[model samples]
Target: MNRQLTNSKLLLKPASASPALHRVLTVPQLWGIAVGLVISGEYFGWNYGWAVAGTVGFAAATVLVTIFYITFIFSYTELTAAIPDAGGPFAYAYRAFGPMGGFSAGFATLVDFLLAPPAIAAALGAYAHFLNPDLSPQWVGAVAYVVFVSINLLGVRDSANFSLVVTILAVAELLVFMALVAPGFQLKNVVAHTDSFGWSGVFAALPFAIWFYLAIEGVAMVAEEVKDPRRSIPRAYLLSIGTLVVLAIGTMLLCAGAGDWRQLATIDYPLPETLAMVLGKGSVWTSLFASIGLFGLVASFHCNTLGYSRQLYVLARNGYLPAFLGQVNERFRTPHWASIVGGLIGLGALFSGTTDQIIIFSVLGALVMYIVSLLSLFALRRNEPQLERPFRTPFYPVMPAVSLVLALICLLAIVYFNLLLSLLFVGLGAISLGLFWRFGRQRINVHLTTLGEAERH
Candidate 1:
């Protein structure tokens, strides 16, 4: 067995269980998923209220958050280009910290991915209120989950196509709304009305602002599917982040200008409400537009699940997870079972409660993963100087360091705002890490031994 374990084939060959699926996602589609998930107008209105009340200026806060996101994407693009693998942050963590760290990162990501679909579905359900206020939120969430899951289960090609369509419609709607409302923008609204520009408001608004800037790395999750990952991944990251920041600033300006900040703060769906007031009941178009945005959210959720499932499949093939999860659907040429599992998790989250709780939990988990990923970038650079890096992080250690710091700040803000809930999430991740180390290590060892025996013969 020792001799067999030394065999070059056993050491270097790819796992038989892992098969490359269709690479159908274009840079645009990747951008769509990243932007769509994070660029919700409703979230901005809901959370930015406090920011408006406390910050020196809404635009300044937007700019600060956007800069942080820009730094994050740069770091992510470099990492994704170096390791264009399915596991994303999981792959990075494994390379930098080892199996335990990898599993923790993957587990955290899974928590976020599992919660995202349902949270977005519930958000979509809320937007459905615009179309038909009587529509049951639960049912709306259920329907959206089913529809997107179906699209996802169909395979990557169809899912990417659907995402592209939703992205186009959503962007167009925002542009049109901006074009119509830009003329009515009032200069007075841009002025900071209160004396809330100190550390208190900045710290208070940081979490929600970070939430708005979240999901910028969703495209990195599908790094393997990108046609020219080295180039496309970075391009998509920049384009998506840039576009989202612009849209956010534009929407904030338009909404603030058209209506009082206090009024916008009180609105459940600020954009639509502002539009309705400015453009009349027909401006209720914000609802349809928001529905489109929700559609984009569903698309993003599907793509996210698809990307993460493939990551799990790779980890399973590596003996870090159950081997059964590594199996691919020969018929669909996708990770069908994993996709179904993701859908079920989303369904459960949808039934759990309101969108806010789901978003908080999902954000908490994602921030943990992001923090680890950013740290991994520095660790890998220090430990593996000879590693082939197709694309180096442009700002090198500085950008990644900044990203790590910002991620920590965001995590702290989450804890500060939602103390008990944040503690619960951290506790859950800690328990998961303990379980993976205690039980998963033994299984991986056994699998390794079995592979060694097979190689020896």
Candidate 2:
């Protein structure tokens, strides 16, 4: 009998009775999954920080958030490598602190993955609008939901292959964008608005800074499907994070220095607009960049759609969410219902609010999940020293401790700046939790009690 907290098999219904997730994903496909889930961040969303914090202030905020993500990812990969579950943060918390902890982290994680695509969808629509002035971005976003969800339903291997190709194109697009804009970059332009909001602006910009790397952790959701969960998951995470950090900072600086940073601050299609500033609005360069920019957004949209579906499927499988969503299509071996439900929800979000609003809400969910996940990492270390760790976080307590503290600070700052939206987020969590408690109390007790007896034997 294994005493280590390496899996929640005891807490879960015997997986032998369940439809298993495929394990065909390799390191490269995992990289595609990881980067595709987040590269859209490079395409749009972070510039909103510029509106609140100005160029220098936002850059400083980005630097701080980058540090937070680096430490957080190093610590988090330990859990993902050991557990290798689709529920990701949810599975980690359940192992460390039982059902309540799992629910808290899982709910936040659900929102983080679920809300992101709609925000990306809005940007997709905005990009379309930029190209053809009469195209309605919201409806264009609606159309994208149809296309990407269908791709996901095809099968994991097929979708992953598509992600790899688009991720390559997205990465290539960013590099091209930087090169094209570099000659126009001027130190004076970046410095022009340094005084607009001062230190306070940095705090306000934290969530947008977070926007730059929001869903990279989502790589964890695909852990079950990775060929070698222990070694492969960690490698994918490290590769994905390194790629994002370089691209994020480089894109932000070059775009800011290329022209008036303020102009890019409030829009969804900042890269295209930034290129227009450098290459002239009607220049072939602006048109080509705008058209190709869709690759980045499509990569993220396609990948995040996969992420949210798996989260939903796992939750349902564990009895936290409605059972119907857990059903995997026997033919495709994918969580088909979860994909459809998540897509419909994301489409509603795309049409209901502004892209920046959806982004902030998504960031709020991510901050909560980060704080809880870091806490779980600490708990697991104290409680389960025997657990297999293929990749240990470099600094141990210090690394995770720093990440936890930074997560707390970012959470507090966003709550302070957006009190109303913060309250709304809380209300949504509370209502969902209330419903879960009402319907799920008995089921959770059954799973935990069964697991407890199994462990004691």
Candidate 3:
């Protein structure tokens, strides 16, 4: 009874005492942030799927992953609208479960957001290498980390506006590339390796397939910053998913059909190189397109930097991490320390692992988050029936259930294929949870924001 009374007191404590996050984002800006966070996948990571599954096998894997994201996003948006917290899944899981649940969700999300930047940074380096063979991609990626983190430190509004412009340019570049490559689309090239790897390879390709829409959920991490999140979240999510689906399928087909799919499967700058295949190595079109291709990579890297910092800031603010990370800059009202700290972690990851390894760890983290988040949705619906869900999920239990089941399947497939790495991931989770269980459990023993407060929002 004493513990319960203490928790109740903490729950009712006013959250306004903490510094306010700038609620300046609108629907268009939200859409840009959503799309921008995942655009780099189209540029680099998805091609690796082809390495494991061949063209047709990888395509099947991508379709399954796409179905998961579409259903998951529709269902997940409800939680975002209802809770409106910067911690994303961590906050939702806490309200649904408890401190242990919140820490679990936070840890998984941290892995996803923190690890993703280095993978994208590696791609930036690869694109740089493509542009100038003399440039070291790792060094170039290192420079990117510094530049974009500085941009984020400036402020959220400035950061988001940059995302909008760069996302538009990235989307335009993609459309143009598709237009140029469409005329040369060949069924023969696409089907050339149709049965080479067979059905088993499709399972092996699941993690790589996830790259197509890996960070789309990141939009939810900034929910506290969105203006009128109740109405804006659903609109922005719908638009973002539709745009990515079309782009993913169209880009894959065009690239496979451009030439032998095998040749482009291993490189980071596949789209530009695909154009080069059609237009020749020295063609002006290939040169200019490759130069502009940096926009898409830059957009994802920049937005992801924003996403991880928010994750770090919220975790710290809620007592899951060191309190220093939660401190906001008085001048910019941004999470300056969070951005810098997350970037430093990303750089360490960049040097320690290969691009493929980094991608697998990131996707693994994503699947864990998906599972935990879906479980939270179910628990919250049952226990907190009165929670003001601005956007209720379509089909309720069925939609969330489908997302949960698919997430389990993807998680199993990835573990089966990458056993060693999966073990390492599990080991890391265990260590973090073990430490939290021993040392700091009391620090976040109360719900910082009660469901009553969330419902009012």
Question: What's the number of clashes in each of the models?
Answer: 0, 0, 0
What are the RMSD figures for all models against the true structure? Answer: 3.6, 2.1, 3.2
Q: TM-score for model 3?
A: 0.95
- Which residue pairs show collisions in model 1? none
lDDT of 1 by residue, 1-457 (tens): 4432222122223355556666667777777767765655334333443443443444455566667778888888888887777777887887777666678788878777677667666666766776788998778878876776666767777777777777776777778778876777786765546564655556555545555666666666676667878777777778887787777777777776775556555434566666766676665565565556554455555566665566566666555666677677776667776776777777887887665667678778888888889888888788778767877888688887887887787678668877888888878877877777877778656666767778569
Top candidate when judged by TM-score against the true structure: 2
lDDT of 3 by residue, 211-288 (tens): 999999999888888999889988999999999999999999999999998998888889888998898889998999
Which scores higher on TM-score, 1 or 2? 2
Q: lDDT per model, in order?
A: 0.68, 0.90, 0.88
Using lDDT as the yardstick, the better of models 1 and 2 is 2
Best by lDDT: 2
Q: Estimate each model's TM-score.
A: 0.88, 0.96, 0.95
